[model samples]
Target: MKKLRYVKDEGMNKKRWLRGGVAICLSAAVLSGCATGQDKQGSQKDLANSLKVMYSGSEDYFYQEFGMLFSAVYPNIELEVVNTLSLENTLLDQYNQDMNKALDAFIEQEQPDVVLLDPTTITSLIENGKLYNLDTYVAEESYNVGGFNPGLHDYMKDIGGGQVYAIPSTFRSQALFYNKDLFDQYGVPYPTDQMTWDEIVALANHFPTDGAPSDRIYGLEMAWSKELTEVVNVLATAEGLNYFNSDTMQMSIDTPAWESIVEQSNQVLTSDAIFYYDYIYSGDYEASSESSLGDPFLEGRLAMKLESNYYIDTIEIAQNNAQDPEDIVQQWDMVTAPVGLQNPDSTGYSMFYNLFAINAASTNKEAAWTFISYITGDEFARVQSKQSYGNIPLRAQYFDKGDGRNYAAFYKLKPINNVPAYHQVPQRFVYEFPSMLQQEFASISDGQLTIEHALSELQIKGNELLATEIMSQEELKLYLQEQQDVLGPGVITR
Candidate 1:
């Protein structure tokens, strides 16, 4: 019997080692050679074969369990896994390489049969034509591609204008995870899936009270790190908002929609309904009040938190490692993140999703297809439902039977109708602008800037930066291709 391990942050892992699925107890070994398939009857004499897999910047448990599971099915194939710069977002960031000489390295180094890629990495590979189109293989196998959310398939094709380059195995989405005990203690019902942003904020209001001690529980706790941007990005995206207009290359932040997001967040922050760790721990939120703060949520000082699938393992690890069995943190579960007012039906956004793709350049396409097919299939879904890694499976069936983790709530509501393109722009100009927005949020917390002035200043400053950040199509294309290396002949330009 295998137990759960703490997962790293969600951005790096769509494979968010769930609490269920194949356990990683199998020596943490990877595929580097060939073997035979495992048989229920216990004979592998005829199933002898080989398959090589390459995955980078991921937990050893994923490969350990995956190797164990895949080997069991086709024990005859030697499952070799190459682990390298597997850092979640490092693939495209590997800009140090010229013309994607990285592909040159693959030819000289170990040529992997299958490459486990995140959306960004997969897109890069697709542009370089390093990936083989799985359409024919998918069709030949008549794979039940319908088990996943239709949007996933649509988004993958949309990226390449109808070519299936990568298969999505796991994804991360935001959810409202509440401390059930707190809700119960106050006789407040747990948050529902249909709750709107204001409704959830209203729910948060139920927690903090004047009579409570200085250690009075906070209403809601957001990770406070980068989530500020993520929350706003989700809202803005759902409303069809973008910081930079790709076509015009202009910045447009002075709008009512963006203002609503800032205002609502301001309301939540001021009302003490939301606790940002930095706003508190930085001695800022306490600049006015004698509020108690720390890793309040981890220390059991918070009643609720906004998180994505990535947070599951961290919380699980905390629960498992607590000094005393039941020191505090009552029962907790997640629900779909609240929807926006204007786009009340919008599903929130995730920074990235883990995608699995076959190496079109692999010599063993047949065996590679077998591996990719099985792992993304219902059979793997059945296997995944058995564990509680932080990552959520794309299949609905797994959610129906998953363990005690409340995995279903993560997907209880649909996500944004589409996956937004990975933003790769001038970090100094386009990206840093959001940080200014956060600063305004912080300023609002400090009473240093009025909300109106903050928005006005944000717009003015943003547009100034946009002038330098805008690029022509040729410039944008070059920017996208920077640091990219071709692993083989397969590449495409969007």
Candidate 2:
């Protein structure tokens, strides 16, 4: 196994403050209820029991509301919900050191019962044995493990194994976010669930570019970096070209699937339908950008942008720039990514979200599990679906809400009916693989290098990184075996 590294410069100050906030919120809620100690005995027991959890937070209103609601239910639990400013800051401590000392120190000192870990952080924590194996917990409780999206569950289980280390809290998938006003102005058909990439291109080409500011409106835009590269990878995978071959332990960007990806990107870049000039590159997807594709889409300068459900919040925020923000977003809608001929079933997408896990060393294991169960349970899933404007539910029933009321819009936009099978196995190569491929692909997109050369070099450089910087094949096998021991034998396969 690879050596565990520590994050640096972590402080418990924010955590302390958040704990205080929860206490204050719960106290207010309890006092406002006017129910005495005897009347609220059961409630008090549920609330007063202390439990600590770590999460990522932003100005997103839903997160705050969820935290407050969680506190209200378990008044005694002393919910310590810490929101690290960003995934990178919390996980790598600004990349200051080879290790994550700061995060490690906090985990060691506070010993939070439950943690909301992102995929990147989950990878590190699982490797270090800092998280509990949740497989037994799920099986013993009959926790409806099969209720979530099979693809997403497989992705998590592959990473943390059958141990069920984490439960997905939310999901964000890439989709075509279009400006309704712009589509109407150009007399373009409103985006539908059945639209193909070629059809999207054709729609984009209908816009008149008559050398006027208004004529400059284009078809689509995407944030071109490691973050957005997942879209391309998803599309390629859907086309039947796996990025990594676990059996051969090799990267396969040299295949025709990869060629299809390059061709698709190139077509978009060089297309007359869109404005590919002044490409804005940001390492982080959620960063604030005045000229971001989202901004332009809101401004009516761009017709469509490829983004995730998380962008729905940003889109609402961006509407402040609009003369009529409400009407714009109300009319605005999203659709699944364009389909390909080879993988007619391919979704051309990927899902990103935060996962909730129990700490291996948590003092309050039962409390932690209770909290995890409560938040990720079917009840919470329904609440979350309503509160989080565009978040896709991981639970199957939530998606299957037959009336087409809750989260119906999101499920409608899903690219494929069947979940991709690749997510079922943890790809040891994911640690640094996506970012590496992103860099190479970006160069090719920018015309700095040919796709052929880039893929050839990527294969060689990727192999070197795997051999030297990543876990050896033997070590990976051992780790997989350990994961299976905790999760169960069927959690992973060779």
Candidate 3:
């Protein structure tokens, strides 16, 4: 049994040492290899094989990040990564009605045993019976997946129409990072788990906002830019309100729910307690702030900011680069991202990007299953946890990086049931809609337009924009098919 280790933030030596230890443990447990198909009674004799994998990145990168570690445990099984950049580019070049035909040809020619796909592509393939079902394999091996994030397996099963077709080794999540010292200095209480958006804003209002532009302390900073629309979008997403209806191809931003969100967001934006990195440094202090350092939160000025798990990497890098001990963000921790008032138990800020699945047409199902199982296993997650900065491990225990910090905050809330409606809308619509919103919001902020009149005007303008940009159903289908490769492998194919 493996026990967790405590890691100090003064240096990254412990992280490096632990990663090295994980490699050693993997070598010692070579025969087990997560006890997938390769380790079974009759499978071991036939384990010597070369497995082909389709990945979005270069072969060297795949080998460096994953292939090397896997080889340490399964020396006989050769891992071949089939880089799809060229194939993806070719698909992107000629995007039309025959896009699926071209994709089919590419798949037949490549015949990769395993493939890394986006969630949307995974769903499409699952629907078309082009992906293998892993439920039978999982049940046969009695694989214990109870350690994964809550509802994650069920989420995948739902995507695959009641069967598990793909698995993600890691996911992306955001949390509310607060500076403990700032809270203590301002005599404000620390934020807790499952906070509602309104509750968070109310708490932020408690902090004093009087000071110079550069030296001021802010209660909250939700985004890097001063875009009120961006902050409003976050709040609206938490509330499960679709500002655009994909099926109808119309704007839904004028609704009461949206109106309320905009009103609240406007209040927060006008309040001096909220900080926008761009706004703060746009004037005389711009040079000083830029010269002083990176990340005001790290600079010990911002009270709290809702940021992604990647922020940990930023913090670690700051600590490593700090020439003076005083420059470090000495005390900080995180809590769950803000939720909606009605649904305070879940958040919409979580996403799984790299989904691994076995090709149903492959003759090497055994080997492919072994590879997939190994990558998604608890042991693999343990090693990967220390290696990656932005990715949240699928396994529950590994979330605790032994750093004695509140790692649980990243995974504390259940993911919202629905994917964002914007994903389903046309790509052009999604890209252009935000600008229209911002223009109208700017008018309201300048006191030239009332909220009611502004929303009404927005609804009219948005419909016109949608009408001009909308593609026919069949055309939309072909467009999505052709553009998947162009958007890169990580794009969600909603």
Candidate 4:
């Protein structure tokens, strides 16, 4: 067995953080040429090991999806899963309903061998030295890390302070899905990869916008949401704009760049070239069903749509179940998601939901590594590649959908930095800011306020919200006084 070193907690899993950083030592194991059950159980072939894993869903579901398959390969290992649903509920109650606090405590208490975490949670654990550095394990087992997406590996290394602490099972990315038949019919050229927002909007304007709501053929459709705010937010994020700066406790929404984006978004949203579903009329189920079951793109009424890889399955299902030849789309392909003008070569739409990590203090480290290695190995990718989970498998080679579509579009663009802006501020601000943005945009659309004025108001109100939520009375006074001295009086309302 290989011995590894980890941080020692002084109290009951309660320490500020490791000041000196984590300690890791190097070691190597003989390489396994094949990812077979016989090759993987080299050192532990004779011993029976029982392993516990922490999962988001129920144990039965995990077994049905993953555990069952894993057990079939390595029957010597017995698997048990601890569901996090009840754990989160109990922790939430104990920690005054503060989810971050609850999650911190949850990690300290639930010391399972293997656990699933989000990127932010993984970062927190890495900082606290609660996660084992997988560098040694990968080296000791001679695991091939090259098969996974290069971007996800880079992201993990960055967050883990140049040492790998976790590996993502799958990644979610957006792509530009266009109807080939619609483009040909409209005499418009097809959309291409790395096209900027301005270019996409220009392309969308080519189709004629002269017909009834149901009968109209829109040039562009955003399948995620029909709300204008969602569109603006997606566009702004692609441009690498951060709404709020947590360090300076400042808002960046009221800039000239933001005003320009608002204007462009308003023009595109109000134009007849785009399909903005009216939720008021959505009460009519029959009317909605006629419109590709709420997806205009599937009905061939849309020229292009921006959606995740999962939408492929939806389109495939629609095509198979079409009552008539025209009821569902027959021909469609995808390109990369729209790029930002600032960083045209990269995108921010790529993300991973399930990041697997091992506890630093687990007693069964060998068994845990075996499971992690098995799940992220070649055989696992080969098996999962056959199914459509609406996500890209880590090992891109095995990703075969049987059709030669542009599946590479999902991962063609290098990912822009994965630093989440929401993690910097209070969760309340993250939840509230979008609605606040929408309300101000509504005023602009109603002609009650200009774009510049709306953004200015948004900035001031956002500052006030942050002040009340993040600072004490005395601190707020000092902050406001400093702000007034820099700018002018009446900039920040009391």
Say which candidate scores most in lDDT.
3
Tens-digit lDDT track of model 3 for 104-147? 55566788899787664555566667788889886754456787
* 154: Cα error in model 3, Å: 2.3
Query: TM-score, each model?
Result: 0.67, 0.59, 0.80, 0.79
Q: Per lDDT, what order, best first? A: 3, 4, 1, 2
> What 10-residue stretch in candidate 1 is worst by lDDT?
284-293
lDDT of each: 0.58, 0.57, 0.70, 0.69
TM-score of 3: 0.80
Per-residue accuracy of model 4 over 1-494 as CA lDDT, tens digit each = 11122121223111221111111100001011124556546667654488888899878657644676577667688998977875555776565544556666776786788878777566667777778999887665457777676566677787677988987776778889999998999889999999987788789899988876656778987523455576778788677777777557688888987877777777667656876545214442123243245566776778988877777766765566666746788888999899888788778877766778888888887788878887787777776555433446777777656587788888777666555534346444654566678888888878899988988988998887766444333544576678688757865442
Model 1 RMSD vs true structure: 9.2
- The positional error of residue 494 in candidate 1, measured at the CA in angstroms, is 27
lDDT of 2 by residue, 1-494 (tens): 11211111113322433444455544554443333323534645544277667765552333354555555555565666655544333434333322344456657756667776655456567778888888777775456766665455556666665446887676656667787788887788877664666677778877765554322566766533223264465445345466556445556667766876777766655565564323332221121234233344655567876666566655554565545555344456677665566654445465545678888887788878877776676655654554433556667566443533223334433333223233222344444455567788788767788878888888887666545433334565687788778868775543
Poorly placed runs, candidate 3 (over 4 Å):
1-43, 92-105, 140-142, 245-250, 284-292, 417-427, 450-494
**Model 4 misplaced regions, further than 4 Å:** 1-43, 46-48, 96-101, 138-142, 223-227, 246-250, 279-291, 325-327, 417-432, 468-494
lDDT for model 2, please. Answer: 0.57
Better of 1 and 4 by TM-score: 4
